[model samples]
Target: MIAPARIRIFVDFWNFSLSLRREDDAFMLDWKPVAGVMVAEASQLLGAPVIYEAMHVYGSYDPAKPADGKFRNWFTTWLDKLPGVHTVMLERQKKRNHITCPQCHGEVKDCPHCHADLRGTEEKGIDTRMATDLVSLAWSNAYDVAIIVSSDRDFVPVADFLQSKGIKVIHAAFPPAGSQLSQRCWGNFNVINLMDKFRR
Candidate 1:
């Protein structure tokens, strides 16, 4: 008998999470059921039985902020308890840059409402970390199929490389605004259609 295909899932936390949010700003996802649905769908796509090997979520948090750090701890704890699920957290790097008015291209030093310094903060390293994990897993022969839940085009190359090695890459994205990653993958599955089965 042929062995079942091993399937692994990689989620870009912020990217996936934000996409799931409805217009009303409610964001909730029941991942256990979602995982089951993904595995079943992948099995059908592969035309073979498949085993759920693992699910990984990559994100970043700022440790210096008490509220953010506390929330990360709580969220990570909840995620770690889920079966076959792992959470990888990276430190959010801080950079100070002046915000300029788009119209005049002049530095905007103060917040219009609160009169505070309008330094913008950006989250870095999350995408690079996720890409590294995806490629590393493929090189290690971790799974026969990888289901990626991210809209970022940064992962397009990874998908191409994995497919070149004969591993199937599937993109699980929402409808209407599918990503470049989806076009590069072996198959594209819309999560929006499955929202009723797995969403909270």
Candidate 2:
């Protein structure tokens, strides 16, 4: 009998979570069951029992934001109880960028009447951190198969690299708009379609 593949899962938390919300506002995710289904599906695809190696979820949280910080803490605590699941939280770095009117191309620092600052806050480093971890794990021979639960095209290059190294990279994505990462991966699965089977 052929040996089962060792599989590791990498999830870009914010990207995957927000994408799911965008895809179906009524949808809710239950991670443990989702992981189980993913492992089962991957095992079937490989035609052998698949071993669950590790599942890493990456994201950032801002402590200054009470609501976000509270949720992050609670969510990470829940994730900690799940087998083989690890959560990596980074401090959310905020940058203030001026917003401009599309037609006028003029800085809109504040609403003339409302006096509200038109500054936009952007989160940085999440994608870079995820990519670094993905490559580092591949170099360390962490798993024979890597399942990525994200739809970001930024991961396309990493997927290509893993494939070149003979590592099976599988893209698990939502529908309506699949990603370039899926196209570059050795195989792909529609996560949205499978959500019902794993829904809490």
Candidate 3:
């Protein structure tokens, strides 16, 4: 008897926000729901076992803003609008957005701030980090193909490397821009209809 085909897919959790927005930590941290939705969709198509890993986050800011109150207000409002969080939380954050970034790791400071160390794989770049995770899953497991959704340049290396391994890399990049990751990944690009994939 022949064994079923194998496939693996990895998604960058944080990158989904290029389109969506978050208002508070409550909904922002509860992203497992979103991941579970993707996993279900993928399982229906792949017809094989699948595993998902949480994506790494590496955010870049204008830097000119020095955590000042005015700067904080602008940054928070824009961010809250982007992920497009729920109206309740959106309105809350738009009116009052405060974040503190002390050296402490888990302690939730009344004022929350994000300080990017600019190291580690994800720190290098979020797209690169997601690609790396995809490649890691692909090589370690017995996957026939790997599906990804990103348009960041850092993933170029990951795509090249995955192709070298004879693993199919499919892009889930949407419209306006398609698989900006590079010629490598875009060549295999397969855009999913955002309208169908998103909530109204």
Question: Which lDDT values do the candidates have, in the order given?
Answer: 0.82, 0.81, 0.46
Residue-level lDDT of model 3, residues 1-200, one tens digit each, is 54544444455434445533332223233332443455454555655655553322234333333554454454346433433221111111121223334664443333325654322221224454455567666767646565565555566677778878876565555444544653575244333332234443
Model 2 vs. true fold: TM: 0.89
Off by over 4 Å in 2: 110-117
- What are the per-residue Cα lDDT tens digits for candidate 2 across 1-200? 87778999898888788887887888788887767888887877777778899888887787667898787886689886699988888777546667777999988788789997656456677778888888898899888999998887888888888889999988887755556777788888888778788666
- In terms of lDDT, model 3 sits at 0.46
The predicted structure with the larger lDDT, 1 or 2, is 1
Show where candidate 1 strays beyond 4 Å: 22-24, 110-116
Model 1 residue 189 lDDT? 85
What are the clashing pairs of model 1? none
| Model 1 agreement with the true structure over 1-200: per-residue lDDT tens digits | 99999999998887777887852266567777878898888888888999999998888787777887886985689886799988888877656668877999998788889997666456788778877888888889888999998888888888888899999999998765556777789998887777777767
Question: Which is superior by TM-score, 2 or 3?
Answer: 2
